[model samples]
Target: MPYNTSYVPNYIKRQARMVLLLLVLFTGCTEVIELDIQEVEDGLVIYGRISNSNSANEVIISRTRGPETAPTPISGATVRVIDNNGLVRIFLEKEPGVYTMQPSDSPGDFGNSYRLEADVSGRIYRTDFQELMPIIAQDELRYEIGVERDITSSGANIENDVVRIFGDSKLPSDLPEDFFIRWEIEEVYSTLTAFLPVFWFPGAGGRGQCYIQNKLGADQIYLLDGRNIRRSDLNNRPIITRKIDNSFQNKHYFNLIQSSISEENHDYWEKVRTLTITNGSIFDPIVGKLQGNIKSSDPEEEVFGFFEVIGIDTTRLLMTNNDIPVFFVDPCLFLGDKVFPLLTVPFGCVQCLLDEKLIEPGCLSCSAITNSTSRPSYF
Candidate 1:
């Protein structure tokens, strides 16, 4: 996935924190109250990750829904990170509750320990100083076509082919045995417009096909526990699987990112993953709040969510339609105008290519699709 400098909401990421928000909403349960746990005054949820990649560091502060209030962003707070060396680096609020550090300032370093401090309304919330570990680069990413069985909504079993990706990683020799690893996968694909409707002249050639780039699966998380493994090299470890679809019909790139995280961070996410599976069943009992490392000065006030410091290494693998064992249908294929219900005319009817099917934006231009880019620089 492209490195984003701006603040993106936790809900938008669809990460583990989004599920934690559900706990904030169900705090009135008798089981949680019996546990002597009181909700944070504002239901504060502060989540952020600062990495060696300066451009991707960001902090998001928002309130979860309470008894009578809807969730909202927390604004006008002072957010900063301080290192063991006494260097205080302030993060500026780019949006309401999103803060990003000035990249030109002191970027994150691997050896140093850092602490996050947020001052809101004279109350201070902070996390214990967490040390950043050395980056662990991915050795390689491998993929193969495999068939998997799926059940339809009507309960009919069917088989579908999918692309399964695996990864290889060689752990650093000097690292402690207690270190943890996390893998994140992202997919970028390209598409082209089948045809262009508007023409300046009778002979005007079809507007050159617009090549659009799209991204997917950036929020999924995969974790690995490195403490027990005696071997240094991890080979052919299963990473992720994606269904073979139209996105594979073009230049598709799978980005595998590896990061070394603290054991505390790993445990927090592990709890989330466990809760997520149990949450699927309505019969399961609601889980109480999963406290994070963030702490507040007032004993009654509790802060939820984690602030993590990590170093990430990424590897990209490019695949095309030729990579798939079976033929994949092209979304842009021109079967017939009737297949596309919407139509429009882009120019004057005289010289304009006035096909009713052209009213569909994708038929006229690939740019009509969301997150579509005309040129892919990585090519």
Candidate 2:
């Protein structure tokens, strides 16, 4: 899985905006005040996951810091996973504080209880045995094209051509009513820049049509409970939506992953999702330190995040250019005879490119825009 830190600040700003909006609506006005907040000692933050897939299992241990400081990864810790049958597998520290299970080890067994144990600085932290829940495969994955108005950073409204992905799944009547379901999505798309005129600079490699593929999906969490569902089968339930842009100008693919999780795991993620959406507002649920299944040997020690074992079902859907409306200007328009000096150029070409900042290097390379130069196996 790819890790992106850029979304963290954007997520925080969006939550802050929601809080301000609610405050003004309820109080009729808003006042800015400064409060001196005492920083607490950093505590342990652990994140780990085990799945039924062949993907490597990983555990990340880090220590929290002040709001203005970034969390530091904790290294030199001993970590292992133990099954109910007494089978033990030690995780190797592949990076600073990242530990991964060996490829020779089992991915994970469904319906079996597993426990995570870690010793950091002579303090043992462990989680109660968590059983992997069984998941029902998604019946279908589909999408529809539509249009919506989006507000820009300057508060200007613009029409956006969007593609919404939906899924269908049938629940077994015999399953427990409290079963929890979560959805994750991954998008695979190819990029082409062959249409652009080839330009060579000193020490620059040849630039031509290179089929590039990229994956996109993270940050968004969708959760549901079987007990709250009224129907046995879900149809046309929206999963995610993306604004159709240059990234979708060619063929695009979506991989939808549905997972069944334990109630404890579901509750932990639900609270986290709520925290991100609510920030800290009077109308929001009272904010508290998030508790996980992991427990420290010392009663006063604090632990954050969780380790989860889940069963997943995945389905893939493909989309072509005809499936979505294109609303983007030609990227090459910015070059304007710069790469092709013999061609007649338009008036105010330099000013237009400078104003739009489209002369930047990315616009000339489709692979540099969003995806990678390497094509995906499926593509």
Best by lDDT: 1
Could you give candidate 2's per-residue lDDT for residues 217-329 as a string of tens digits?
34334667666655567766666778787767667778766677888887766555223232111111112245678899998987876888877666778887777656545
Question: Which sections of candidate 2 miss by over 4 Å?
Answer: 1-40, 137-139, 150-157, 193-199, 207-220, 273-288, 327-338, 341-376
Task: Go through the candidates in order and give each one's C-alpha lDDT.
Answer: 0.62, 0.60
Q: lDDT of model 2 at residue 94?
A: 79
lDDT for position 34 in model 2: 27
TM-score of each: 0.73, 0.72
